[model samples]
Target: MKRRPRRSVPALLSALVLLAACVLVAVSAIQRILGERAWIDYDTVAATLHNLHWTDLATAVAGSLLALAGVVLLLAAIVPGTATVLPLAGRFDSGVARGGYRTALRTAAAGVDGVSTARVRLGRRRIKVRIDTTRTRPDGLAETVRTAVADRLDRIGPATSPAVKVRVRAPRRTT
Candidate 1:
């Protein structure tokens, strides 16, 4: 009997990692809130609040973080291959700029000879592109993708150098 190959171990691992990360971040935030409360007990903190109360900033911050954490966890759980984008931390003039950048990079990679699909991420200091392609001449395919990404970067002129990561999977066979 022929064995079937796995479809997406890396994707699964990434989602797990993102979920774990979101949990960790939430834990850290909660710990900070608790620590603040304990360290500056109400007896001591009340004086500061009396002088400069700002409508419960601590609760506001904590609530906001909790809400963000919940959203991140929910996205990580529900979206396949979407966890990596859960905590999108950065500055873009608008959502269009961010989406355009991603679309441009993915399109560039997909235009390469053998790439089946592409995922692109723009970080503060670096760009990462993941390409899924058939395992037909892996070395040559990788080179082709690298060249395509470089060309796209030149055209985009983003302030960071893109690190192209290629995942070559065997093409699915049809009987």
Candidate 2:
């Protein structure tokens, strides 16, 4: 089964804000209908709004902030979140989580001979591998790591195979 990306945080926040405003407005209206004191003094608010001028600094700032919030909410609604899982090639039954995939790639890199430690950062189309070794002249180590990572990737069989990039460094002592 395919996995969907998580919802945007900004979008959720905007929805919550709108819901709160609606609830507040409804409660005030209900209180007014009951002939009781409303939560908000509408008469006072109307008078204040009538006296407020566009040239006022407070009015300008409030308008700018509202416009900015609208733009942010619009962008949040339009942009899609990053995928959580990558689908496997020819397999509709399962997919791999990004964390698990990165861990597997790190294991493949570290399994190479002379690799003291391995670090991996994975992207949709790029796999970056960094390895530390003890040997001063770590010749062919990068290629070996790349090959091992590629082999592992083949076994996992992601729908899209990311290009493997390997960087090997020999440990050094600073005087």
Candidate 3:
């Protein structure tokens, strides 16, 4: 039941970064072997490391930052992402795109009578519909919108139907 998106982008990014680092180090080493100055001065870095104190504020801060970055990358790789599509009831491999489903529900809600504007929010287990109308007597408009939305959801046919809630904004009353 775990429907997570692929982590191709992260894997590609990590590979590119590692490749770049390796290329830089190899190029510097090749230049040094050919009796030329290295792009990154390995001798100077070694000297600096030997002379530096680990208790220094700058060293501690840099180490902390590197450690934090490693932890963040680890978490990003391990965490599962949310599913972009919703599963249908019938076929195991068939599913509907979330954006398309949301658009359909919005259209259904907007098509209802007395609904001037409709906003539909699709959550993991709920669909909330908020509507505004110019009609003064919009007593049954909310229920009508709810029914329309529910019918549309049934038509689309997700594996588990989310609960539909409707709210109607009343027009201003004048004495």
Best by TM-score: 3
- lDDT per residue (tens digit) for residues 57-162 in model 3: 8899999998987887788779877677778888567888777988999999999878889988878788999999998878788889999999998898889989
Q: Per the 3 Å backbone cut-off, how many clashing residue pairs does candidate 3 have?
A: 0
Estimated TM-score for each candidate = 0.40, 0.74, 0.75
Q: What lDDT is reached at residue 1 by model 1?
A: 14
lDDT of 1 by residue, 1-175 (tens): 1122333654576579889978776776676677743422445556765775346878678779879876766665565442122222236522225667778878998898778887887665556777777654556776787788789877666534646665555456544
Candidate 1 regions with alpha-carbon error over 4 angstroms: 1-96, 171-175
Candidate 3 at 38: error in angstroms? 2.7
When summed lDDT is taken over every stretch of 10 residues in candidate 2, the lowest stretch is: 1-10
Give the lowest summed-lDDT range of ten residues in model 3: 1-10
Global lDDT scores for all candidate models:
0.63, 0.86, 0.87
Superposition error at 10 for model 1 (Å)? 31
lDDT of 2 by residue, 1-175 (tens): 3465755578688779999999999998899889999999778889999999999999999999999998877766677655678788883667989889889999989888899999998766898999999987887999999999999999999888989988888866544
Clashes of 2: 0
